[model samples]
Target chain A: MTLELVVTLIIAAAMFGTGIYGALSQTNLVMIMMGIELILAAALLNLVAFWRYLHPDAIEAQMFVLIVMTVMAVEMAVGFAVAITRFRSRGSVEMEEAQELKG
Target chain B: MSVQVIFLLAFGLAAVWFGIVVFRTHSMVRSALALLFSQTAVGAMFLVMQAEFLGVLQIMMMATEMSIMAIFMVMFMMDPGGLGEMDMKHQRKLSLWAGIIAFGGASGLALFGDWGPIATQIPDAGEQVRLLGIELLGRSMLIFESAGLTILTAMIAATSIAVQPPHRPKETPDKSKEPYQVHNHGGAA
Candidate 1:
């Protein structure tokens, strides 16, 4: 059981690392959102692992997971909407070219 | 190793691998699909952990969300197919260092941290779900309701932001022509 938790945590850490790379390095708005999605997934994985291994009886952990999932969904929605608006206005969603909002 | 551990490792590896793929791929569509697969693998991990409802919810939600993201990629990307061999990254060195540091720190914590005694007895799947439901509707009712409201607001905000504003016709004054004389309607009446 301890081994499983460690493995899961390590995996989640790897994912979190990859997401950090993606979110920080990606140029496009959609790609950035994808990175954010992965990060949130990592958080969810950690939450579930803890709930299962450490506090199996605590339903509140599950509730927290659901809330995180909702946050992920809402974030994606708002992100895509912003991407759409950016594309409509500038004809490109590249972050490098978004100097208009730099101030 | 128990069957559960094996399954957990498998799904965990799949999730990490596909998460890497999401960034390695140049094609926007491929990236989106890779993210979908990664999230699905995470869902499978949830199932391996015996959180049935969460696993199903993760899979279902990610499927729809990533499909929409794929569609958006096609619509918004200049080269969705990645045929141009364009590099889509910035601050590569910094990001690499950040990623490595984050992984090292998190893994070190996981490996060294003393997480108290592991719970050996988990409720059955059905009971777990029932208790989760009760918790959601009971003590967590406020949080649940807040989340719902936030989603509704996000939906509305997204729609409004995405919708094109009505174009009002520009009133071009015909300066070349004489202005029309407006007769007093009251005097005429």
Candidate 2:
């Protein structure tokens, strides 16, 4: 593999690792969402990298990446709404302490 | 050195650096911001690979989404400043081990795999943009529309739920209780 590809891969891996860490580590609801967003970005990195590597000729990968972007926007809107509801109802946003649905 | 190699190295190093920052930080907003930078770097790498469409998409989506996340952090989260340290209770060791394994496996793959040369030589980069536009509007039309609706719904839901109802003051005393003599005295005054 070329050095450039190697570097890209390394970055992508780091993004992935950090994303997982964020998603898993933070207890605050917003923090967890941020972590999830990071993970999504990491996954997008992998997609874009592969797109550049093998599909330079076709625009398919690029188009697909755009779709992912739209999805991300939608996710943020919905996620924030859910978080707001939780905050309003319970007066807190910490995921660890939320047990309204627990049996 | 080839342009691809140079672009890859720059983007890769930036991503890793930002990624590390994201992991190390306790603040959610900072982590989100770090992730945004890392995404941008990765997008740059995509441009190097000549996948202009994906690269642009990466920047637009990743950056905007992260910004929205920051907004949510301010509005909903009790501590808008993210002043306190994150609750890192059980998964620290597990996350570390998983991260290490993932990194090692990725590095090994990178070392061994010979990613072939760029698939096509573009005589006109402009045409690629037109083609990408066609693809997005044509093949991905439904997906795009749905995404718009989803965002709209989320906006509505968040605003409706987050805002508290205005408190209405009770004007009348309970019928079970006698009227206060203070009210009659106040009327005389």
Candidate 3:
């Protein structure tokens, strides 16, 4: 592997680590969502890196990335809507206290 | 190192730094912005990798997403202004160790893993984009349509769930005691 690709992969690894830290440690639901976003970004970096460096001619990776991006967007939308609903009903988005699933 | 490589290194480091800052900051809005900065740096790294379409989409999409995200932070988070100094985290030591272990595993694999052959002949940028378009509209069309339909269903579900009243009949009795009476500020403040 080239130095640049290796560096990109390392960056992905770092971003993943930070994201896991945030997602696990944060009690705030929004902060956890931000952590998940970082994880998705890291995944995207890996996909783009692999495609650019290893199989540039295949072209299918681009579509895969696009689909992944679409999925991310949809996930954020549903997630935040749930957050808003939770805030309106329970007046809180803290994951620790949101134990009751029926709401 | 070439100039491109230098730029890549600079952007990569910035991305990782901001990713760390996202969790370290006390303010929720600031944390979202830090995430935005980190994601933007990743987009720049994509540009450094010479993937223009993906890079541009990353910057634009993340800009929109994170902006809306800041609004949510202000709406839902307690003491988002950071005046209360309420700790927003839990399980700090355990999570730190988890993160460190994850990094160790990833780095070890990245360094030691046997990645197969690298393609030596990459098509020109324009040619690559053209092929990508054909690939998307051809073999990937069914996948795209399915994803589009799924997104449509999700949007309808989310809107219905979020826009409708929080409390309605058929909800469990204990929860509906004070119908529609929501405790403001997370029931903590």
Candidate 4:
């Protein structure tokens, strides 16, 4: 209900939008992964904003955000590891060329 | 507006600007750096919002992650400098429309949706942190332990996968190659 909360939420929304656009438009796998990271970041921002605004007394939301951060870190590491593996085998990380997964 | 609001507005604008540059730049390294700046600004916003521990954690984690990401960009990108003028993006128009629609929907929901009553009584930062610590080690101990284990597993898995495994009769390439002989000096760039 506060202006601070409203502004923060708006920023989070913009960030999520940008992430969607980047993930959809990028041809490179790394770029797409970056987009996904953005989306995760946006989600984090939203969670923290809501928690700080609506439920500051409750610690559950903080814990949830921490868990989300852990997931984001692990996901990025694994995603890039896969990208490197693909690059080593296929010589490029283009999503279009990953047709072997079309089964 | 209060000083806190002013700081939030400033940092938020910087974050949003850098976020836009993350996708706009052609150079992979530049994009990574831009994202880094954007994320750091977001962390600063958290600090201004009075979540000190979370804000610090956000900055530390993102800094480390983004540095590793930049190193990976240089290692794996075919043209890190973008001198080759590669098309880093595709379906631009559709992407723009999609982004706009998403923003509109989210903003609408955020502005008009009925969220439960905002808590009027809030504890101070010290009390909040104390309570958070207790909750983490007490009721949520299992979840925290599981997350820690998963993160450890992820780190080990990433390292094992990334490092080249020794295949046939371990020939040490680094040991075999002599350190610079300085023969017929190739002209410096």
DockQ, per model, reads 0.75, 0.57, 0.63, 0.65
The alpha-carbon RMSD values of the candidates against the true structure, listed in the order shown, are 11.3, 9.3, 6.2, 4.4
Best by DockQ: 1
Interface RMSD of 1: 0.9
Tens digits of per-residue lDDT, candidate 1, A1-103, equal 4888888999999999999999999988988898889889999999999999999988999999999999998998899889988987788999999998888
Give the winner by DockQ: 1 or 4: 1
| Docking quality level of the chain pair in candidate 4 | medium
lDDT of 4 by residue, B85-160 (tens): 6676778999999988998899888888777565546666788789889989999999998999999999899878
Docking class of 1: medium
Those runs of model 3 whose alpha carbons end farther than 4 Å from true positions after fitting are A101-103, B80-84, B166-189
Q: For each candidate, what is the lDDT?
A: 0.90, 0.68, 0.83, 0.83
CA lDDT for candidate 1:
0.90
Give me the overall lDDT of model 3. 0.83
Better of 1 and 2 by TM-score: 1
- Flag clash pairs in model 3: none
True contacts kept of each: 0.85, 0.65, 0.70, 0.57
Which tens-of-lDDT digit does each residue in B1-189 have in candidate 2? Answer: 776677677777887788777667766678678878877887777777766666776777677777777666656544444656654434777867776777677767866887866444552457878887776678877776676777677677757765665673545756897643433546756
TM-score of structure candidate 3: 0.87
Question: Which ranges of candidate 2 are over 4 A from the true structure?
Answer: A1-3, A100-103, B26-29, B60-64, B75-90, B106-124, B153-189
Cα error of candidate 2 at position A47, Å: 1.7
In candidate 4, stretches whose alpha carbon ends up further than 4 angstroms from where it belongs are B80-84, B116-121, B168-189
Best by TM-score: 1
Chain A, candidate 3, TM-score of 0.93
Candidate 4 has which clashing residue pairs, if any?
Answer: none
